[model samples]
Target: MKKIGIYLSFAALLLTVGCSDWTQMEPVDQQPVRPSEQNPELWAQYTAALRAYKAGSHTLVVASFENGSTNPRVRRTACAAFPTRWTPYR
Candidate 1:
């Protein structure tokens, strides 16, 4: 009876390990190129703005970001940052 139980447990373990569904797993989606590669101007603008902010030059960082890009998304995102990014201009 003990030998039969061991055989059944071994068969259950084998089935559990062997029956995993690899076909359902999908490959990772990869970016074709970095955003900077396609839009260097925007990337440079953001990088400079970030550095200016980190260097504690809060008032001047806004000027550096306003690069006159026609993209509304950039303008909107930057505008949204002003309220939180600054602290009473101390």
Candidate 2:
């Protein structure tokens, strides 16, 4: 029948459109490495802050370090150690 032929053609067209080649997805830049990654002291400071937060010592956790350290590297290291989150002392 002509209706059956038309239905098959429409189904073929739908299948052709649905079976697209989706292999080339855009690459995502996941979790970029920071310059501080190479610096051991900076990493230590960051880890210490994280540990303090985990240990629930909110007061001891430094939000920001004094910027006036004689060594610029020390100041930078301390700055990186700043806590990412602050919880009020209960």
Candidate 3:
């Protein structure tokens, strides 16, 4: 009975280790998504903000998002997130 149990365990381990081909498996072919694809207006806002941010005026960048946004959270978030895109922290 002990020998039978050991053999069954070894067989199970072998079956698990040999279950899949390491090289022949296909890679996932998922395409990257851009904000422009889902919401062009939001993309435009982000790009405009990014351009403004690159030019060094942050106040106008945050204020540009004043009232046109339907979601207040995105407005507040964009205010916080844009400036941190470049950092030296030194």
Evaluated with TM-score, which candidate comes out highest? 3
| Candidate 3 wrongly placed segments (more than 4 Å) | 1-9, 16-18, 21-24, 57-90
Q: For candidate 1, give the lDDT.
A: 0.76
Kindly list the per-residue Cα lDDT of model 3 for residues 1-90, writing each as its tens digit.
Answer: 999999999999988788757647688999998879989999999999989888995544334545455565664555545565688679
- lDDT per prediction? 0.76, 0.76, 0.76
RMSD of 3: 15.8
lDDT of 1 at 77: 59
| Residue-level lDDT for 83 in candidate 1 | 77
Per-residue lDDT of candidate 2, residues 28-56 (tens digit) = 98987775778879888998998988888
Cα lDDT tens digits for candidate 1, 1-90: 999999999999988888777546878999799878989999999999889888884554343555355555654555555676657767
Residue 12 Cα positional deviation in candidate 1, in Å, after optimal superposition: 20
Alpha-carbon runs more than 4 Å astray in model 1 = 1-31, 57-90
TM-score of 1: 0.30
